[model samples]
Target: METLRLQTFMVFMLSSCGFVLSFQINHLLYTQSNPTAPQTLDRNDASSILNSNFDSSLPVKFIIHGYRESGNSEWALKMKDELLVHAPMNVIVVDWQDGSSGWYFTCSANTAQVGEDTHLLISHLQTQTGLSLNNVHLIGFSLGAQVAGNTGKRNPSIARISGLDPAGPDFSGKGASDRLDPTDAQFVDVLHTDGEPLWQGGFGYYEPCGHVDFYPNGGTRQPGCGLVGEICHHMRAPAYYTESINSDCPFTAYPCTLGQESCSTCNGNCGFMGFHADKSQANEVFYVETNSESPYCRG
Candidate 1:
C-alpha cells in the first residue's frame, strides 16, 4: 500500500511539471514573436514605429498587404506614416511575399492560415503586454482584405476591420464567403475603388450597411495599365482610412460624383450603386473623391 501511494505522488508531480512547462512555452511565444518596427519609420522613434504590447489604452493597428506587394512598399509605408501623423497608435505590418503579377493564386489557400497567424500575433501581444483585445484594429488591402475579415471573424475581440478595395471575385465560395459581411465581423468597413470584376470586386456582393451602401466614384476606374498606373488606380479609393477609423457604423448614403459614375461600372442593382460593409456607427468615415486623374494617386 505504501509503494502504491509513492507511485501516485510521483505521477502527480510529473503532471504538474508538464503543465508548468506548457505554460512557459506559451509565455515564450508572447515574448519572442512580436515584430519590432523599423527604425526609419518616423522622425519620432517611440510612436511612429513600435513592438506589440498589451496596454488596452494603446491603440493597436495592423496593416496586411495585398497581392504582389510587400509591407515595405511606398504606399503601405505611406499609410503607416500617415496614421502616425493622424492618430496615436502602435502599427504592425504582416509580411507575406509571394511573387506573382498581383494576383497570386496560392494566397487564396493561405487566407485562413494567415488569419490564424494574425490571431496568434494578437494573442502574443496581449499575453506579453497584459492588454485586452479591444485595443486592436486591422486594415487590409486586396487579398489581405479576406485575411483581415477571417481574422476578425474568428477572434471576436478584434475591435475593427477595414477592407480597402477588397478583392471582389477571388474571395468567393464557402471558405471565403464567411469572411466578407458586416455580420461576420465585429465592426466591418469595406471600400471599393473598382467593384466590377466578379472574381475581384472591391467589397464583394455584400451590403456595407442596412441602409447606406458606399459607392465611391461609382465603383469603377478609368482605363490605365502598367505597374505604377495600376498602383495609383487601386489607391484612389478614399474609404480606406476613413473606414479604418470609423469601424463602419451609423450607415450614411454617400453617392459618387457624376463624373465618377460615368467612368464607373454600376453593379446593376437598383442600389444600382456600389456595395459597402458597415457593422456599426460611422461618424468617422471619410469620403475623399479627388479626380481619378489626380496627382495624389498618380504619384
Candidate 2:
C-alpha cells in the first residue's frame, strides 16, 4: 500500500525534477489476412516491412502491450489472434518490453519515447504504402494506454484508440494531455475493469479517459475475480476485448449516474463495449455486467 502511494507521489516529484527516461521500442506488424511470419520493425526499419508483406489498402490496427509485457504476452497474442480470426486487418503489435520491463518509475517515464516512436512508424507506413492514418486503430493496455494516447495526440488523424484499463499509479489524476484521454483520437474507448483507487490496491486509472468508457461489474472488483494477489479485474479488460473479436454475444452497456459504479438497468441507449463498439453509437460512463467465465458477454 505504501509503495503504491509512493508511485503517485513520485510521479509528480520526478516530473518536477525534470527526470527523463528515453529508449527505443520494438514494433512488430502481423497481417491476419496475409498469414506470413511477423514483420519486425522499428522507427529505423518501418520501411523494411513496407516492401515485404504489407497491404496499404487494408485498415491498420496496432496492439500495444503495457508495462512488463512483450510482444508475446498472452493478452497481446490472444488479441492478435482474435483480430485475425474476425477481420482482415494489418495488425501491428508494439513491443516495448525493453522499456516496459524494469523499475516501474523508469517504465512510466519511457512512455513518452514509446509514443514518439509509434508516431514515426505510422508516418513511415503512410509514406510508403499510402496507408491512411485515418484508418489506424491503436489498442493499448496498462501503461501502453498512455503511449497510445500520446501517439494519438502526436498524430491526431488516428481513427480510434482503446485503452484496456490504463495504468493508474503515476497517471490516475493527471490531465488528459499527460495520460490516456478521449481527445487523443477521433474515437477513444476505455474499459475500466480495475479502477479501484491506488490506496486500495488498484493499478488502473479510474477516471473516464475515453469518449466512451465501459465499466463491467463496477469496474473495480469483477464478479468472480479473487481479490488478493489477483489483478484479474485489470486483466479482464483485455480478455473481454479479445473475446469481443469473435463472440456472437456482444458485450453491451448503459450509462451510470455520477457517484455510481455499476448500474443494473439496461436502456435503449445501450452501446456495445468491445469489438462491436461503434464510436458513433457510444455514450459516456457506460455500465454493464458480464459472466465470470469465457463467453462473458451478456449480449
RMSD of each: 17.0, 3.9
Tens-digit lDDT track of model 2 for 146-168:
89998998987789999999998
Question: Per-residue lDDT for 30 in model 2?
Answer: 83
- TM-score of each model, in listed order: 0.60, 0.89
Candidate 1 local lDDT, 103-135, one digit each (tens): 244555455666766776676556555656777
lDDT winner: 2
lDDT of 1 at 18: 14
